[model samples]
Target: MTVFEQRRQALKESLRVRGLPALLVSHAANRWYLSGFELADSQCNESAGWLVITAHGGDTLLTDPRFEEAARRVWSDEIVIYSSRKMEVVGAFLKSLNPPALGFEPRSLCVRDYERLREFVALTPTEGLVEDLRVIKDADEIRRMEASCVLNERVMLALPERLVPGMTEAQASWEVERLFREGGASGLAFPTIVGAGVNAALPHAEPGQDRLPAQGLVLVDAGGRLDAYCSDQTRTFWLGSEPSDRFRHVLALVREAQRRAIEYIRPGAPIAESYHLVRRFFEEHGVADRFTHGLGHGVGLETHEAPSLSSQSRDVFRPGMVVTVEPGLYWPDWGGVRWEHMVLVTEDGCRVL
Candidate 1:
């Protein structure tokens, strides 16, 4: 069987185990992951397509007229085309099944669409049916992600050379993009973030007119995408010949925190342990409040996926999972410093990707 076929088969068994006769895949990434339909829905109200998988080995692709050709190239068995109303077409099909209810991913449908679909058939909300499978990377996916990570690291290392004192954050961000493209990446996993000086305090700060001073800190969070796989990492660098005592201390603390967290990852390990390890380290240093956000998240077809590393998460590590380990400290007045790296969960421990 092709990889797509094998994935669908696995999903079929999941439905059987859940007492679901069928499933409606609405999330764009899940659709692509299951069927190889590369088109994406740019807006929440819009859709490139949907997959209706049946436990009885049924394979169906539902899309609009704009995606008919592309849908055929990916799925050859059954294709349903909707011209003006997608929910109506979808509802009618589900009603035909005439089961008590059918399972669908709530993450895929907006509230407006979900309400409309409710008028036609009983809907069962399901989560992680496909994601549980996607989190465990296949051999080919691991290889692709490794290549993307390698390319991403190269671009980040070269960013310092392309930047200089007084360069605007926007200019530095553009240079990061150029390096990734020139390094043979198809695209960026997400926008390159270049936060200079105090601007880095904003975790998701947008690259702006803020300038890198003669002696300050620069935090860059970036990633490259190759062959539909994604890579993500962050680095915080100093500008002066010698970093201030405070900066050196915080940097070392964060680096060590990150080191211990990475070492804590392994098969069957609690997902939240890695996150708590970093948080506890910061707390000991009396900077716990400054360490915002989770330790990291899984990376693959999407920049962020399942098996998240966060105190609120209830997952456990599993072999073949690719996740990031990023521990950061952000100070509104002093900017921020974040160290991120990707690792592959293995049988014994994890390998730094």
Candidate 2:
């Protein structure tokens, strides 16, 4: 079934199970997921661009006239469009339907929006009513995400060639972005991190005009997006004549840690175990504290999503789940080494894509 149809079916099932008569999807991403209507930037105005889906399969798209034409062009024929100046009209319309138990996305609705919603209808906070359905990829979603990964991998493979010894970090960053777009990416998944030498110790360092050292370490963390799905990857390189023994040792340990984490990932495996395995590898190298961050995270519509791989995470690895296997060690006096690869969890094991 189409993504929208599947979403509608899932919502219907959720509403039936929860005893809710209708659901209001206010979050932009959730709305896009349910209705396939991309909200215009102006839709964030009070009560505009809201979607109300009834338990009985009725769908309505409420927005201002500014977005009527765009909404018609994008939404399905089943989605009835409502134009109004006052934002309260959406709530009034919902109340007019008089749903017994109205649902709202608890994770997406802010306190301010929740209070505003309370002004019109009784809203029952719903958890994962739509997000749970979105965790698994439909064929089209997977296709777009795979295309995004391909572009990301291509950019990663090409990054080394652009890293001249004297090029500024900002210069290299601009080139990387240019290459991503030229390579068919819609845009960078997030802000690019290009750190050399001492700056490499910072995990999320911003790219700057600092000229790269002729003989030091260079760490690059970047990715790109395609069709709204995202791909993230990180690779640390030796820009000098050759990495020192100390640097090589750190790189080897970090790569080994990342490898072990990926190896331990399988269907039904606890995410904490993978993180612990990475920590153990670092501890063996006497750099446990240097590995501060989580081992990995799920990547899809968002660069970082569910099923985080870390000590605090209780999520179990499942088949068809796309996650990153990244482990690193950073020493303030020295530098940092990180190896990241995006992989798909399978029945047997993870397959890096």
Best by TM-score: 1
Residue-by-residue lDDT tens digits, candidate 2, 1-353: 66676688788888887788888887776777877776223344444477888877677887777667877876764444455434476667777787766788776666876787687788898876776676666667777878888888888888878898999999989988998999888788888999888888899989888888888888999988888788999999888687789888888888888777777888989989999887887777788999979988888767877768889987798877888988888888777888899988877987888
- How far is 184's C-alpha from truth in model 2 (Å)? 1.0
Write model 1 residue lDDT over 1-353, tens digit each, in one string: 88999999999999999998888898988998999996368776678888889988577898888889988887977888887877788778778777677788987778887798788777899989999999999999999999999998898778777778898999999999889899888888898888898888888889999888789889999998888899999999888688888889888988999899888889999998898888888999999999989999999998989888999888899999999998999999888988899999999999998
Candidate lDDT values, in order: 0.88, 0.80
Worst ten in a row by lDDT for model 2: 39-48
TM-score of candidate 2 relative to the true fold = 0.91
- The most accurate candidate by lDDT is 1
- Looking at model 1, the pairs that clash are none
